[model samples]
Target: MVKRLGLFVIGFSLIVVIIQVAIPSADGRFEQADATPEKRPFLIVAGLDSLTNGALTHKTKSRYLDTLIPQMHKTYGDGGPGYVPFDSIYFKQDHHQLKMSRRLKEINDLEPGQYPSQYSFDLKGLYTNKGRSDWLRFDLKKDWTYGRVFYLQQPDGGSFKIGYRHQKFIQVDTGGSLSLKTIELPKHVQDRQVVIRHISGKVTLFGGIFLKNGGVAVSRIGQGGDLLRWHAQLNNAFMKQWLQQLKPDLLIFNGGTNDRYRSSVGEFRRHLRHYLKPFEASKCQILINAPNAVKYKQKRLLNFIHSMKAYAKQHNDAFISNQKVLGNTFQEAQQAGYMGDWVHPNHRGTKKIGNQLFFYIREHVLPSYKKEHAGF
Candidate 1:
């Protein structure tokens, strides 16, 4: 009887081992990223704070990140709902259902549209129509749980009347020369149309409309003519104010395209270190992206890219080089009609960059990060 019981126990132990070998760990099949949502949350902080209004609508922002997110999930697994920190900026070129009349300047002076996530709006035109009743009209794309509009007041700035569907109107008095003013949106029962009419002074610039959302939040954070200095200039107080709310576990830094002439290789590395100083206590894993190839400034740009690669290596952080993955020249992209100018790539170029980054993270970054940190 004792011999028979021992044999049965051995057989059961063997079955358990086979089951363990067949099934994946609790985190899921991919060892690339932490699929366990509650453990590690991903956050993408792209573009510049001043450039946040590039894509005003949710749909447009989704277009910018569509390639990256799904591919990220396929490769790294959905790490759950991502977090977006700031929401006071977004701009969509065509708010599909809205109607507009009157001549408005479609200027990309800010060239905010250079970033796929950015939607450069008619700021000067909006500011110019001071006395006109028909300034600008657009239907809200979605019901925002809460919303806000950021505006810049020039020295001559006076006032503007804002109304929602002709229901409620408010006159915002801008004291002359006020740099910036934030208008709090009223809590709405449903999605509605809004109109802006000039009341007094020139509302020279607008940060754009911002809305709240759940799921992966891809933020645009680049400013034209900006180097890495803008990173330190961001509202750190505000960021820390809602750090808990953001709950970010991974922060990806993608810049230096605008910094080709701004810094030498040594300064580039120093600036990167300075930019990262603020987040030292945040405990989020940082990743850096090398700049994409631009037609001019070939040698200086290459030096900057090399510096970024070195920084990523020395610091042991994940680094993805756009120049390496997307090719050394913009010839292919330009031929494909991706270049908007000598410097920036349009939407098509943006999509290609996203795809390349996705594959790199999937094949190289993920596996290495998992081995070092177990998951992130």
Candidate 2:
């Protein structure tokens, strides 16, 4: 009887095991949202200088974007809501091959604040417009938690209250709400991209409030190379240590503007080559962006940049001309009168330039780069 009972139990258990294997789990999510199955190891940003940073951006009022902040979660999977979204603001391609990159790493052994792309690195001055009332909206100003801000004094002398499409608990320099008497903004607006128009065109221009947020973010090292290459000790050890920590996927050499504002051809190429040596060691694709020379100091900078571009192409490595876009914006600036100083943009100018730069990278630059290297 015991043997018979044991046999029955064994058969029943076998049936139960079979039933479980045939049934699927209760949760319906079959694919992971934050993934492509595999991930890249690391990226390094090389060759950063001051003008490479905006020449006159106010550091006190601007927030730097951490491109890695979003990616951090992908590796650890524990940052806020989830992994950092490469956001693909532009990366969309069905096919690509991993070509051997010709980039290099700089400052392998240095200290912090020494590197231009470091989190601590900031612009030289606030290159912003004054006496201008118009403001351009970047991303819809909803859910803005915190960030730096700037404004104009208005022709009539009333305080300019920066406006937002939608927001809450968002604070500026001193944690104060904007004056409702002058500015007007929607309570909850959501714009996938930035858009703007003249307040003179509307009489009631929307106020702008630059807010701060935390996520995977990145910023172009603005234009500061003017004083930086001349002042920054280039390869000081502090700069190298910073690179080790930040390890950016790409470091853009958005310079040659200051270089083009040169006294002679030798001086221009000298500085350009000086940066290249250390940069070659950084292991990042070096994009030698030439400056679309404006009449800086009465110098036709665009022409000089054009010459350097030809030189870059001679090597057949990796350098492209961005002068066209820069030139177009400059022409637009001239037509709009936003080039108030005939140089740096005013509030209206900054927004337009910023959006233009952002879009160029999004549309032109990002498409050429695939998020993954399939053939490698």
Tell me the spans in candidate 2 whose CA falls farther than 4 Å from its real position: 1-216, 219-225, 236-245, 256-263, 298-300, 314-323, 326-332, 347-356, 363-376
Question: Please, what is the whole-model Cα lDDT of each candidate in the order they appear?
Answer: 0.44, 0.30
Off by over 4 Å in 1: 1-42, 48-66, 69-214, 235-245, 330-340, 346-348, 360-376
Taking the tens digit of each residue's C-alpha lDDT, what string does model 1 give over 316-354? 778776556446786755676655556555566556767
- lDDT (tens digit, per residue) of candidate 2 on 1-376: 0101000000000000000001112353222111111333223232233222222334211111222223333332321221111111100110111111112111111232232212122211111122243434344212322222222112332222233333211111211222111111222223333222222211221112222222222333322223223323243232333333333445445444444343355555555555444444444445554433244532445545655576567543355443343345456545664443444434444344334444444555444444444321
| Top candidate by TM-score | 1
Residue 166 CA error for candidate 2 (Å)?
Answer: 35
lDDT of 1: 0.44
